[model samples]
Target: MESRNPVIRRYADFQKPGSVLGNNQGRYDGNVITSTPVDETTQTFPGRTPAKPGERVVTMDDVVMKSFAMLALLLVGAFVGWNAPGLAIIAAIAGLVLGLVNTFKKNVSPVLVVAYALLQGVFVGGISYIYQNLVVADGTNIVGNTIMCTMVAFGTMLFLFKSGIIKVDAKFTRMMMVAMVSYLVIAVISIIASFMGVGGGWGFYGVGGIGILLALFGVGLASFSLMLDFQSIRQAISMGLPEKESWRLAFGLTVTLVWLYLEMLRLFAILAGRRE
Candidate 1:
């Protein structure tokens, strides 16, 4: 009966106090699936092993699934607030505060995490509503385009991480943050100039010839954010962290991915608007 409980089921290693499972030290035997652990195998005692070397024996799926579940709750929350108008704004503020709280906390709390997700949904859905109603795209394809671009950017990032194409280093993260801040500063200045009826250079809004430059810069920001997410995943895997962490991973990814998509959307909009 205890085995059926979600929390207890994950404590299998804990249940066995003196064995390798309890001590947290794996004893690799020659056979991969046998009751012993080998250099490249994880024992699935009393039956199977990881099966192959260099294979991902541990995945972030647990985190991803839980994260999506939070997101699902968020979307429902968004729908409720969307039809109600003022509620979304309230939710947005609450979401922002929760986001900061979650980011600073070392341990993940399902309640806060889920609450944050729902709050963030309001912000996203609100923006989607504005874009659909105000912007002109290929009819019903704007939302689809946004979603597609987001998924593609995310998938590309995941592929790069898996293929050893992008190495995550402390220096890399610092440089990326510097560049991102610079971009944000420039964007703010451009808006200020526009308000004054003065035109600045093309660096901020993809105006002049700097639009592509800004686009690449946005991509770099998203990529570095991915690196940080990967770092967290690595730590969780090594520490035998809880399976619920998968939700946190997904939340982090969704944040970065959504930011990347918006940047790309703006870049495209700038280019398309110019062409028109």
Candidate 2:
């Protein structure tokens, strides 16, 4: 009933006195209380025993399963797109639109979340193929290297978060948001410059040492974003969000991972370009 919980504060409507959400299992009447306790009695009749009712709150297994489902769909889409890189552009556009829709929508939609994952897979696979062709002429397997680095970074962040080494307090969250906004602005400027034929072929991204610096900054931001996502999942579980919201959590993690992967890819590409 405390508003101090971030997840509860965000979803206050779901925690209304009469609402069936959170741990509010019953209401007090003038002379008695109403409750809906689960019936756990096992019957030995011909009919199968009724299954036990599951907890209403989110769980670790729920989050894990949802994430796995999304990842599987993404891999399938990636395979299709990798073989046909021509669909990358369309997939990228569609992914961007779906990402925005999912982020702004009031309620989570499993279909939209899955669609976004699929589109992102296509975009990622296409880009990976292109990047590999560009820098892996000697068969260096840059894509594999990038994936390894991304997973390592993800695991390191998760460990730090679980160990309480990296707390996601208000100050940390604010700082990361400001940093992300600044990075986005710089990226937009670089993109515009590139379209106008500025800074040779790399635009503002290649100005002096900006490319590598920005790439490093982006990677750091993406890693921090992972921490934020993990904290959010913890908060949701603590506040007893509905199990269905697990899909939303999964989508958030997927988005952060994709961003991290792209940043890693860019960093590796910049380093390879410098070597050449």
Candidate achieving the largest TM-score? 2
Residue-wise C-alpha lDDT for candidate 2, range 1-276, written one tens digit per residue = 222122222333322233332233332222233354422221111111112234354577889999999989988988988888889999999998998777667677999999999999999999899878854466667788899999999999999999999877656766766677787888888888988887566666566587788889989988888877787677555444566778877988898888899899978877776666
Q: How many clashes show up per model? A: 10, 0
Clashing pairs in 2: none
Candidate 2: worst-modelled 10 consecutive residues by lDDT = 42-51
lDDT scores of the candidates, listed in order: 0.55, 0.71
List ranges where model 2 is wrong by over 4 Å.
Answer: 1-55, 135-138
The RMSD (Cα, Å) of candidate 1 is 10.6
* Candidate 2 TM-score, true structure as reference: 0.79
Give the runs in model 1 whose Cα sits over 4 Å from its true position: 1-59, 77-89, 137-140, 197-203
Q: After superposition, how far is residue 35 of candidate 2 from its true place, in Å?
A: 11
Name the lDDT value of residue 14 in candidate 2: 29
